[model samples]
Target chain A: MSAQRRAQVLLAILAVALIVLPFVSGSYVLSVATLILFFAFTGQAWNVMMGFAGQLSLGHSLYVGLGAYAAAGLFFHYGIGPWAGVWLAIALCVVAGAVIGFLAFRFGISGVYFALLTIAFAEFTRIGFDHITWLGGAAGLFIKVEQRDTWDLLNLRGTPKMFYFVMLALAAGAFAFCTWLLRSRAGYYWQAIREDEDAAQALGINTFRWKMLAVVISAAMTGVAGVFYAFYYNNLFPEQTYHISRSIEIILGPIIGGLGTLFGPILGAAVLTILADSITEIMAAAGIEVPGVKQVFYGLCLLVVIMFLPNGIWPAIARRLGLKDK
Target chain B: MSAVNGSPILEVRELDLYYGDAQALDGVTLAASEGEIVAIVGSNGAGKSSLIRTIAGIETQRRGMVRFRGQDIGGLPSHRVCELGIGQVPEGRQVFPSLTVRENLEMGAMLRRARARLAQTLEEIFELFPRLKERERQPAGTLSGGEQQMLAIGRCLMGQPELVMFDEPSLGLAPTIVQEVFHTIRRLHERGLTIILVEQNVAVSLKLAQSAYVLENGRIAMNGTGAELLADDRVRQAYLGL
Candidate 1:
């Protein structure tokens, strides 16, 4: 069989396994799977900007925070459903992305400087959100829990299994969307700009416009992930949602799996989530109290990956499986 | 220089470019008419690259006019200049290293006019440089220097440019490869493509070009027909090493 066909068959098998997982597994396992899909979705969104466009952003939590706050704020005050609130979330994030892109690109602040600028914006938003009484400020905001026993897909009040399925569908949708984008003209332009901006510009690509498009799309997707976070957890804390550490969590999947490839974020999220959960479970059973052990583990994994497989695990695995040409 | 009529396709008048306070190009003036291969030959740091880059809109000229087909295009971005039918094979053959050869050519045909004829252009480019066709699936960075140069030229041509600028096309290559590059340039010129070639290889560039300009210290030192400049004592002593 051809490498592409082999890959498709492998994906089909994996899809079947995931679909069957909730039926065979218990509640805890279902929850873990949901977490994995959540990270995968967010990581894919981040990858579009960083991996595809070569724009580093260390303040992605800004979008998540904005998205969560927009949805939760609207739902709390105006009794709006998250479905309606997500539009506002997307708009807010796109505007934020545009402003940041304009400032960074116009002033020629790139590389680490651009990254720091993103962090600064996130930090500023966090501080502002902490003081905004309309959104509950530093105290945190909570959504009213519904007492309905039946599944309410419209209101998003349902059992953990329902949530798991919703997350799975979202992850799958994101994967398909990214795949389509990677095959499109915009995708080629993004990759070319990523490789060398000057060459891309000389070849008639408007670098500023394309880079801004990447930022806007990526932010919008991350905002959707934030809406999921708000509705699933039913609460939003400015400190927690906008934390730099939370941003790091969103990107870990793509970094660990592979930066530019299609399946990297999905595989990375699965590997990181499962391993971290298992490690936590093992430590808990052994009567060990480790604070931030997962963070330390992530750092170790990143260090090892950088030292060994610089392109991340997915490329190497794909090569070994004969799925990618050298 | 022999008097040739009709408006120049590309005209740069009193262009002054600066990198901070250091002036890279000082009031440099040159023009190229249609169906002419104009050569700009100078030693290292003579602002030949700067002149072409300014004309292509890569560098913003603070005090000058760059007119392409009678449209003033000074200070327009590089992409806009390209959209106006000016393509450049930049210095060092800056191909998108991670992209495959086919994808690199596709990027060259990104503008609307070129994209409309993408398939035909691809076939033509492949015919012009068969090595690109053989390595169509290979990443561009893996190609040899001569192959990369050829790919760069082929890519620029894919844009269907009215005028193509080559910046040091023979910068670092074997003598035979350099000859091959000049031969390709000659073939392109014979097909009636206007070209502006920047080179340090004075003799070869003069032989290939109809008219030539000599730039020294960010200024136009001399301008004449190719034979006139080649016979000039100052040109022979300074650039030709005669």
Candidate 2:
């Protein structure tokens, strides 16, 4: 078969497997799959800016935290449903992204400095949220989970199975969106800018405007993930949600899977989450209590992946399977 | 003020450029008329590339005016300048290395003027450089130096630009490839496109150009017909060893 045909067959198989997963698996496996999907969605969001546009943002957790707070604060206090509150979350994240993009792109701060600016903004938001007592401040905000027999899909309150499907839908939606973007004019322009900004400008691409658009779109998408995170976990803590470590975890999927490819983030998320979960489970069964074991495992995985497959696991797999990686 | 004279397509007046505290261009003034080739010949660090970059809007001038077809275009971004029909085949043949040759060519036709004629233009370009057609699916990075330079020039042409700036078009190419590049430039001129040619091969550039300027220490040292400059003793001593 041709590479494209082989890739299509593989995609069909993967889709069928994911769709039937919750039917055959128990609740534990369902929760892990949901976590994998959540990371995949967020990772795809972060990938657009860094992978496609070559703007590295190390503080994507800022958008996720902001989106969670905006939606959860409304749902918790004003009794607004997440479906309604998600728009506010998206807007909040877009504004924040614009501010950062403007400050960085307009002022000619790029590369590592731009990344530092993102981290600084996340840190500032985290510290600011810590003092806001109305939303429970640093003590953490809790959403009262009512015992409901029926699955609430609209309000985003559902069992592990429902949440798994929701997350799957999210990842699939992001994949479709990114696929469309990669084939669009903006996608071509973004790749050109990523390859060489000066050359892209010489060819009539408005690098600044397109770069801002990338950040805005990425932030808006990340906000949706935030809304799902708040409702699924039933709690929001600034320290846990906005932490730099959380940002790292979100990006790890894309970096390990494939930076710019459509399926990289999802594959990376699945591999990392499953392996991490399995290792943790094994440790628990052995009755060993280790601090920062998850972080250490992630670091080791990154190192191993970088050493073996410098381009990421997905590209290697794609090459072997005669698939188009990007 | 120039030998090959017509209505000026591009005009640079009293252009001053600075990098940090050091000045790169000082009171540099030149113009290229419609349907003629203008050669800029100077030694390394004489600011030929800087002048081309400034006119292309890649580098902002500290002071002075860059007018295209009698309209002031100073302070406009590079993309805006490109949209207004200024194209540049920048120094070092800066092709998108990872992209396929065809994709790189497609990137060039991004201008509104070029978009409508993309297919026609691609056909013409393939006819002009058959090797590009042969390597259409190959990554540009894998191409030979001559091929990459052709790709760069082809990319600039893809923008459907009326005025294309050639910066060191012959730099680092083999002798035969340099001949091919100059031949392409000559053919491009014959097609009614005005050209701004910068070259390290002073003798050949002057021979091909109608009017020429010798830039020294960021200032125009001599401005005349290519023949006059070629025959001048000072030009021969400084740029040409003859």
Candidate 3:
């Protein structure tokens, strides 16, 4: 078979496997699969800004925390449903993204400076949330969980299997959206800007507008992930949600898989989540209570990937498989 | 209408630029008439590139006006300036490195004016550079310097610009490729592109230009017909080594 056909068949098989996975697995394995899909979705969102548009954002947790709080706050206080609250979350995140994008791009802050600015904004938001006593602040916010035998899709309160399917849908939907985006006009403009801003400008691309668009879209997509996070986890904490470590976790999948490719983030998330979970399980079984062992494993994986696959594992894998990536 | 009857297609008046308290261009003024080749010759750091950058709207002019077809375009963004139909082949062939040659050309036709006839423009570009067509799928970075230059010029032309600016088109190129570049510029002039040619190859630019300006220390030191400046003693002493 041709390489393209082989790739298509491989994709089909993978799709079938994911769809049937929850049925064959226990609750623990199902939860891990859901976690992998969550990371894959968020990683793709972050990839739009840094990988495609060449704008590095080291503090993407700012959006996630903001989205989570905005939706969770409304849902907690006014008794609004999560489905209705998600739009508010998206709007809030887009506004935040616009503020950051305008300040950075309009004033000519780029590269490491841009990355630093994102972190600063996220840190400021985290600190501000800590002081705001109404939304539980640093003490954390909790959602009222009810015991129900039936599925509640509208409220996002359901069995573990239902949450897993929803997350799977989200991951699949994001993948499809990114695929369309990469082939769209904005996608070409983003890649052009990423390659060289000056050259893109000379070719009649409005660099500032396009860069802002990338951030807005990326922020909105990440907002959806935040909604999922808030609903599934049933709680929100400023310390845990908006921390720099959370932002690092969101970006790690894309970095380890591949920066700009479609399937790289998904592969990276699956590999990282499965391995990390397995290690944690093994350590527990052996009665070895090592602190931050998961983090150490992640660091080791990153080191190995950077040393052996500088372009990330996806490109090397694609090359070997004769699949067109890019 | 005014542009058709022998008025300048691009005009710069008393332009000035500075970089952190250092003046790079001082009161530099020049014009390129429609269907004319205007060569700008200067030594290193004489603000030749700065002038082109300012006209292309990459650099903001500190104190002067840049008019395109009598429209004041000073201080506009680079993309807005481009959409107004001014195209540039930048100093070093800055084609999108990882993009395929065809994709690079496609990026140029992204302007609204050029978008409607993208296929036609692509065909014309391929016809203009058969080698580019031959290597359509190859990454631009993998191409040789001369081929990359052709791709740059082709990319610029894909915008369907009424006027095109060339900035040191022959820099870092092999001798034969330099000749090929000059030949392409001459062909483009014949095809009715109002040309602004900036070059260090003094004699050849003057020979190809209808009018030319000599810039020194961010100022217009001399202005005359190409032949007049080519034969002048000061021009010969400073740039030509004659």
Clashes of each: 0, 0, 0
Q: Cα lDDT for residue A106, model 2? A: 90
What's each prediction's TM-score?
0.96, 0.97, 0.96
Q: Tell me the tens digit of each residue's lDDT in model 2 across B1-242.
A: 65246669999999999998899999999989998899999999999999998998878999999999889998898898999999999888999988999999999998887899999999999999999999999999999999999999999999999999999999999999999999999999999999999988999999999999998889999988889999999999888897
Residue-by-residue lDDT tens digits, candidate 2, A1-326: 99999988988999999999999999899999999999999999999998888899999999999899888999999999998999999999999999999999998899999999999999989999999998889999988886445589878886788888889999999999999998899899999999888889888888999999999999999999999999989899999889999999999999999898888999999999999999999999999989889999999999999999988999999888878866
Candidate 3 residue-wise lDDT, B1-242, digit = tens: 11343888888889999987999999988888899999999999999999998888888988999999999999999898999999999889899999999999999999988999999999998998899999999999999999999999999999999999999999999999999999999999999999999999999999999899999999999988789999999999999998
Cα RMSD, each candidate:
1.9, 1.6, 2.0
Q: Individual DockQ of the candidates?
A: 0.74, 0.78, 0.79
Query: Model 2 segments beyond 4 Å from truth?
Result: none
What C-alpha lDDT, on a 0 to 100 scale, does residue A272 get in candidate 2? 98
lDDT of 1 by residue, B41-121 (tens): 999998988888888877898798999989999999888999989999988898989899998998999998788999999
Q: Best DockQ goes to which candidate?
A: 3
lDDT of each: 0.91, 0.92, 0.92
